[model samples]
Target: MIRITFPDGSVREYEAGVTGFQIAESISPALARSVVSCGVNGETVELNRPIEADARIALYKFDDEQGKHTFWHTSAHLLAEALQELYPGIQFGFGPAVENGFFYDVLLPNGEMIKEGDFKKIEDKMIELARKNEVVVRQEISKADCLAQFGAAGQTYKCEHIEQDLADGSITTYTQGNFTDLCKGPHLVSTGDIKAIKLTAIAGAFWRGDATKDQMQRLYGISFPKKKMLDEYLLMLEEAKKRDHRKIGKEMELFMFSERVGKGLPIWLPKGTDLRIRLQDMLRKIQKTFGYQEVITPHIGSKNLYVTSGHYAHYGKDSFQPIHTPEEDEEYMLKPMNCPHHCEVFAWKPRSYKDLPFRCAEFGTVYRYEKSGELHGFTRVRSFTQDDAHIFCRQDQVKDEFLRVLSIIQTVFTIFGFGEDQVEFQISLRDPEDKEKYIGSDEVWASAEQAIIDACKEKGIKARCELGEAAFYGPKLDCMVKDAIGRRWQLGTIQVDYNLPERFNLEYTAEDNSKRRPVMIHRAPFGSLERFTAVLIEHTAGHFPLWLAPEQVAILPISEKYNSYALEVANYFDTVGVRATVDNRNEKIGRKIRDNELKRVPYMVIVGEKEAAEGTVAMRQQGGGDQAVMPKEAFAERILGEVAEMLKATNLKPEN
Candidate 1:
């Protein structure tokens, strides 16, 4: 008999070679029907895979992320099969599951081609194949035999992929009906399990993501077990497309990119600059209250700086090349990170224990050489500003400092209207077996890891732990947030580093009169201003919160006749610190309102003959409809009150 331990810590004795499906059936019929995959020990595997030894297992259903990944992986295979049937002699490349769905890269035979219009036919063929309910069979074969089979079948792509990527001892293939593909998989039992399918788009991609390789057709798709779920997914996708930040940014004239200026470099228009400054001012105030001392750092640093910090070894080749001095051997680089400069700052002054836990903050703009193909608008940019801070604290103070940082993150999220369920915290720790890769001693690493774990527990943060995900220097706590469209984006990060201090030989005089290294905590509440702004734009659909809006209120005149009244109202708003603009163009009131609404201004204040005579404005709130009419003074007071409330809610301190 073999013992299997379940996630709930319950153990059951079973015969050797008992399959996960059989085990699920013994527990409950519902579990047997719903469980799509199982995690044996720590690795996810098919539910049908037989267990031969004592192990721990967790059954996963469609609701779990892992289960969804397995389901989509199988869906990709089914897609490949349908493509082969639709276009005979199509050679296949990689087809892996993505965060939302799956995609397949293939080379069509001869002169055959695929376009967006071809999606329906392929989707229909996939549905037909799925209805057959053919079982997906997995087989392990020798490298020689696998090569021979694909070579005979004239699948040069598959043959090249196997020869170049797969080792002789680790080779497997999955066959379903008349289609077979090389894969390392945990697929669903059969094709019939995929009840619904949607082929989203087709694009050109380089083979295996190598620019020098042959370009292949990339097909994107999604699948679900029920038609209703597929419908809901499509609906969400539609909403997402409408909320795409790139589109909204263009429509609102907040930011733009010029091919002449360069790709991936975002140019902040006047309105976007106003909004960014406001965001920075808000963060500056918050950091002040949190006992952070703000400082400025250069956009570029000496190349040797990164060499000592270990960034050059990791990102050197991929980063922009160094700039050499005219007559000196010295070279400088556009700073890819702000931590190394901050490290130099700490080492500048000798410190005592009383001066421990020194927090340095900076809104530092850094540059990196992101590949042109990987560039997106604002989100993946070549240059961006980081709301960065580093805390140099005594070893015993790590937990307390982490808790304080956690509070800052929580405050920022709450101010932005992100709820508890909309965000998740990930605790990343170093890999134990490869201690040499990290800088800190085992004792310091253990202390830092435990401190972070305990701090999360004390703060009531329900975080998931991931090993081998830590920064090479230390452990970290990463904040992953879901935007309005349900897409997850990594926003904030807090990393505990014992490595930098050691490398820099940083020390503070302890009470015992001994010099000891202070642990460093690297944190960024807004990971990068560029990326955060992009996410914020998408999340709110360009209707920003009143305090963050570039133009919180637009004074729209009824016509040219009421332009003076509109200017008066705008002046009043400006006096009260509300970002307000007057729309005095020679157009109808309706046209002005529609234009401002399209610009996503939060409030629309209308001034006409009636309002002008009475010295009042008709207020229209975005998405909230009309608010009550009020006199200019009353309106300014109301706006100020709302702004105060927002700042209070965000725990933003007054700028010092």
Candidate 2:
């Protein structure tokens, strides 16, 4: 008998070769019936796949994320099977499960194409195949055999991928019914688990995301274990479309992108700029209370800067090319990261151990050469500013600094009205097998990971630990926040780094009067202002909080006579620190209200005959209407009070 340990630390004696399904059957009938997949020592695998030795295991059901991934992965195979039946000689590219659903790229034989109309037919075919209850199968095979099979079938894309990416000893395939594809997978037991299917869209995609490669028809799809879930998802999709930032941003006159200016470069209009600056000021205030010193960094840096930081080796090719000089061979590159420059700042001064936990923050703008096809408005912009900060601390101080950062993040979320349930944390650690992808030794990684885990536990912050998700330098704690529509976004992150200080040869004199390497904590409560703003826009549907709204109030003159009063109200509110604007157009009150409402400004103050004479204005909220007819001073006081409450800091200080 071998010892199998469960996630809760309960161990059981199981016969060797007992499969995950068998183990589940031993525990409970409901678990055996509901479990779709199992994690064996952190590696997800098919439930029926046998275990040869003792391992830690966790069973997953359809409701869990891992279970959804497994379900979708099987659904992708079912899609391939349906397409194989419908379109013979169709060569397949990568087909993988994405966050929302799945997509499979295929080269239709004889220059054939897939269009919108084809979605239904394919979706119907998938449902029919799922009803057949075909048992999905996994097989391990030699790379030589994999290449031979695909080549024989004229699956040129698969053959080329296998030849270039896969090694002989480490390859696997998943087969369901008439379809077989190369995939390293943890698929559901059978196709029958997929009770609902939808082929969302069809697009042209170059194979393997290489723009120069042959273009293939990419079919996007989603599946659910229940039809009701699919219906709910469809409803959310409609709501999401209505709240899409691109459409709302255009309507609100917040931000825009121009093809002539270049793709993936967002131009913040006046309103958007105002909102972003307000956000920056709020963060700065909180940082100041937390004992953070803000700094300024350049938009470009010497190539050697990244070389010393070890980022060039991993990301140089993806960055904009080095800027060449006319005078000599000295080359500079558009800064892809702000951390390296901050590292230089740390290296600028010799410090004693008393100066440990030195924190520096920057609203630093960085650039990346984002492919045009991959860019998506502000969320995936080429140029964006990060609310970045780095804390240089001693080993024992790491947890305290991490908790402080967490508290600051929590305080911000609380101010924005995000509750405990809406925010989740992820402990991202490096992949043990792919050591080359990460820097630092195993000991360093283990220590960093443990530090994060311990900090979260001490703070009672429930976090999901994910393997192979760390930064190249170290492990990180990522904040996964759910927006108003219940869609999860990775909004904030704090990472621990032991590698950078070593790379830069940075040290501080310890109490023993010996030089010691200082540990680094990289943090960004708002990962990028552009992406956060995009999320905020969609989250509130452009109806911003009063304090963060670019124009908190709009003064609408009822007639030509009231324009003077409107300007006076605006100027008075400006003095009281409420951002307001006078709508001096000669439009009627009704028309003005409608236009101002579309702009999503929080409050509208109507200046008419009674209000101008009485030194008061009629106040109306954008969605909530006709609050009160109050004096201009009272309105300004109310607005200013609300702003003060929202911008309140947490006093997030360090614990020595």
User: Candidate 1, residue 458: CA error in Å?
Assistant: 2.0
Best by TM-score: 2
Candidate 2 lDDT, 492-537, residue by residue in tens: 9999999999999999999999999999999999899999988888
Alpha-carbon error at 108 in model 1, in Å? 1.2
**TM-scores, all models, native as reference:** 0.92, 0.97
lDDT of 2 at 508: 96
- Which 10 consecutive positions of candidate 2 have the poorest summed lDDT? 647-656
What lDDT does the true structure give each of the candidates?
0.88, 0.89
lDDT of 1 by residue, 382-449 (tens): 98899999999998899999999998888788888889999999988887876766776888789888
Per-residue error for 456 in candidate 1, Å, reads 2.1
Task: Report RMSD (Å) for each prediction in the order shown.
Answer: 2.7, 2.6
Clash pairs, candidate 1, are none
